[model samples]
Target: MGGYGDVQMIDENGLRMDGRKPGDVRPITIETGVVPVADGSCRMVWGTNEAIVAVYGPMEAHPRKIQRQDRAVIDVAYNMAPFSTTDRIRPGFNRRSREISKVTKDALESVVLLELYPRSKIRVSIEIISAEAGTRCVGLTAASVALADAGIPMTDMVVSVASGKVNDVVVCDLNKEEDNYGEADLPMGVLPNTGELVFLQMDGDLSPEEFKQAWDYNVDAAMQVHKLMVEALKGGANS
Candidate 1:
């Protein structure tokens, strides 16, 4: 969250500068099974953010410590491509990417029937080819679709989104400017069918009312995103 805060991102009409009605997310597009070499894969674009995810295995799990005797483990690697931002991010592991990967892995593990594939591993790789903020949410959501495309059994898919405050007004799916100049940020991974949360994070400041608004936006956005994910999987089957 940005504390510099000099930008006005809301208008007198209670609409965001991007014309969203405080609860509306930007357009999203999703496509699954995009990488032929991988077991399953998906690509998603939300606003200007784009992410691609690939899934592999239920194969033998490596690294003795990471293996579970009773359940399969999920190995997630979330990375931002060199050209993902206006200023390139040097490739390789970093603390931020590591943390995001860990959290995303945790979220997916919650829904995946890990016990069914003992001594195996499910690998998820998320690559951010373009970013306009909220890359983590996009990555997590895309990973779920890729896993499903791989025919992995799971309780439900995960839908992710972020909401925040700008100019004291809450908004859904904050864009680059909104995120850089915003006052708060809340991102979540939701299971739309069960209305349960698998991931959550927050920073900056939000009043009670503002927090509620942001939460609502994330939930609504998850439902909208879930539809796109399902459509992507269906399209993948036909192709």
Candidate 2:
């Protein structure tokens, strides 16, 4: 949460500076099979954030000790290109990346039928080619699609969406500026088919009423994103 509310991001019509309504998400596009060598791959662009995710191997898990006898382990490595953001993040693991990766791996593991591939490793690579505000959400969403593209069995795909408070009003999908100055941010990973949640994170503060509104907004946005994920997979199957 940015926590500064002096800036006026909302206009007289209750529209954001980017002309989006409080409940409207930014434009998004999803595509599959972007990486030829990977077992599964997906490229997703949301607003100005772009994430390319690749899934590889239910291969033999190395270093016998880490191998699970009952279920496959998911290794997620999330990275941002140096040019992905204005700050030029270093091209290696950082605290933020590690945290996001662990959470993402946990969320995906909940939906994927890991028991089917015991003593194997499924690796998910998330590369942030560009970032606006919701790169974490984009990465998680794209990773789920990549996993599906690899023909992994899963109960449902995860749809990651975030809602934030800005100018004392709750809004769905914070843009760069809004995120920098917003009051609160709540990101959730939802299983659209079952309406179940696998990941949840929150920052800043929200009133009970405001929190409920944000949760509703995230669920609604997830449904909308799930539609796109399905279409992208179908398109890939045809192609």
Which structure among the candidates has the greatest TM-score?
A: 2
1-239 per-residue lDDT for model 1 (tens digits):
76676777788888877788888888888888788999999989888899999999988999878889999999999999999999888877699999999999999999999999998999999999999989999999999999999999999999999999888888899988889989999999999998899999999999999998899999998998888788778884322
> Distance from true position, residue 231, model 1, in Å?
1.5
Model 2 residue 62 CA deviation (Å) reads 1.3
CA lDDT scores, all candidates in order = 0.91, 0.93
Q: Estimate each model's TM-score.
A: 0.96, 0.97
Question: Which residue window of length 10 is worst by lDDT in model 2?
Answer: 230-239
Candidate 2 residue runs with Cα over 4 Å from true position? 236-239
**lDDT (10s digit) by residue, model 2, range 40-107:** 99999999999999999988998788799999999999998899998877776589989999999999
